[model samples]
Target: MSNEEKQAPQDQVEDVIESEVAQEDAALVDELTQANFRIEELEQALAEAEAKAAEEKDAALRAVAEMENIRRRAAIDVEKSRKFALEKFANELLPVIDNMERALLGTVEDEAAKAVIEGVELTLKTLMTAVAKFGITPVDPMGEAFNPEHHQAIGMQPSTEYPANTVMLVMQKGYLLNDRLLRPAMVMVSQG
Candidate 1:
């Protein structure tokens, strides 16, 4: 009950309070460290997720570009198919035109066959008009310079009236469908 005894008990209480405060500080520091580690793990996970999303986005864009290219190519193919669709049919009708032309040439001088000739001429004119509407055009290369791409040389002849390598005569006229050659013109080329 003296002053020393009283001072000793007070010191003991102060030590106990200091010890509790130190333990609490240590626990708080440990919790803070664990929280910092967790935050770092979460940030790394977020970065990985962002990288993966970027990769997927790039792949999706590439796929879309490829699809667009394929669509464009398909459209071009369809347009080409539409343009050349009548090539085969026009080819088959060429011989009929040639035969009609031959018949007309033969019957021109006959006076008695005048009515028949007129009918045939009218028919041929109608046929020509019909074919022309469908982009079927004749390649009559008479007097033009010989183009091997459009005219096939059946034979060559010497000519003073035409320049060298000119198309002097067409044996069989060619036909075109949509500016594309259905058949080459059979021609006689002039020689130098």
Candidate 2:
């Protein structure tokens, strides 16, 4: 073959190689771009999944804390219920206790024995202490203003010794549990 012909063939081969290399480079660039896009998509999905997981964890923690608080409150409620179970019964017994106290303190016109009086007084004081520990208290509104909420005006007495609408005498003492009235004070209010 001639020299020019050989050079022509060599140049054609170089051109073919360059074209093939360009095609390969283009394919590689497209693959790299596709891979980058896929990576970005995967990263977004991962971030979303992580965020969702964090939110779920926080929700679960809050729910658990709420349940714990409820359990603690329930326990406290049960304890309070047990402690105050006698509240109603004690309320009912307040009148009896007051009657006992009144009977013991009244002028013994009858020939009552000294030993009997001492025994009765001691019993009353003891009972009063026990009920007092359970939040029961006596309301002896003697000389205090007669409050309609705590006092019952059974009789009106005209007296210059006391102000009007004042409790002259507590006929039967009242009792209270906490702030609740077990029995209202039976009182005689002075009208004068």
Best by TM-score: 1
Rate residue 166 of model 1 by lDDT.
Answer: 95
Model 2, 118-152: lDDT tens digits are 78888888998988888888899999998998999
Instruction: Put down candidate 1 lDDT per residue, 1-192, tens digits, no spaces.
Output: 999999898999999999999999999999999999999999999999999999999999999999999999999999988888888888889999999998888735677688888888999999999999989999999999999889999999999999999999999998888888999999999999
Compared with the true structure, the alpha-carbon lDDT of candidate 2 equals 0.88
CA lDDT for candidate 1? 0.93
Give the runs in model 2 whose Cα sits over 4 Å from its true position.
1-7, 109-115, 141-172, 178-192
Question: What TM-score should be assigned to candidate 2?
Answer: 0.71
